[model samples]
Target: MSNNGGNGGGSVLATFEAGTQGWSGTSLAGGPWSTTAWSSQGSRSLQGDITMSAGSQHYLLKSGSTNFTGYTKLRATVKGASWGSYGSGLGVKLFVKHGSSYAWKDSGWVTISAGGLANLTLDLAGVNLADIKEYGIQFIGASNASGTTAVYVDNVVLGN
Candidate 1:
């Protein structure tokens, strides 16, 4: 349970155990997103077809008002299939929204090897945690052949 009754710190934001778990996907490249059997925890994971193109933002988001006032970290398990590369410029981020404003925190460019699972942690500094009306994942830019990459995310949690 979260401090604000599942809307804040000490909460599992998503596990993808029950369908999409309120998360939806969108991408500039028009790739599809869904829940897949490949997961690091539970029975499913959120899968997004992210394009390895500059300026393309592919994400899976859940809209809600959450009070994450005391949380300083966001964690998740991720894996990628057919990933082209895992070097500089290839990264991911977590974003939180308050009203019309949004704050983003990078995952320090954590590497997700081809078909390998990895734990990702991002700092929640400078975010308006008190009124987080939306939260999501962002697949950052990657300079590779123009193609789509399959990425899976699971066990998203918020904590100290």
Candidate 2:
């Protein structure tokens, strides 16, 4: 996989084709374990049931060909489910790795508390991508909070 041109003028390095069913079977770097979709704590939300469990369900992505030197930007579009009292509420955590056995460090988290859609972005300003071996997206929430909350994610892009 190659890094996408910062100006949005190059080919895609890698992409997860989330089908209508809301789940993708591919791994981060052709790994063995399959990354599951989003999970809910209660009834299934309308945003499309793609969620993680209270603990598991973290998805990893390898940069492959793209390596960053300076500032980089990552963005994604997501739709939250309209279930429960607050509807489809969720939080996303971003992580980055520097080496093969290195642990994933938290970059940031974006919370979606409404029933509508929201756009999230994070700036990798001082991160060193040279040693970044893998990046991950994890869902964090409480039990009884309706793990069945649905979510729709698309158009994940990175730039430098």
TM-score of each: 0.75, 0.53
**Candidate 1 residues 48-138, lDDT tens each?**
7766665556777788777877789877777777555543444566666664555444556554445656677777787777877777777
Counted clashes in each candidate structure: 0, 18
What CA RMSD would candidate 2 show? 8.1
Candidate 1 Cα misplacement greater than 4 A, ranges: 1-9, 28-36, 83-89
- Per residue, candidate 2 scores C-alpha lDDT tens digits across 1-160 of 3434243542232334332223332211222121233322112211234444443243534443246454376555555557533333456655566555664565476766746565555566655666666554554543424445445454455664
In order, candidate lDDTs are 0.67, 0.45
Q: Scored by Cα lDDT, where does model 1 land?
A: 0.67
Worst 10 residues of 1 by lDDT: 1-10
- Superposed by TM-score, candidate 1 places the C-alpha of residue 9 at a distance from the truth, in angstroms, of 9.3
Sliding window of 10 residues with minimal summed lDDT for model 2:
38-47
Off by over 4 Å in 2: 1-66, 69-71, 83-88, 100-103
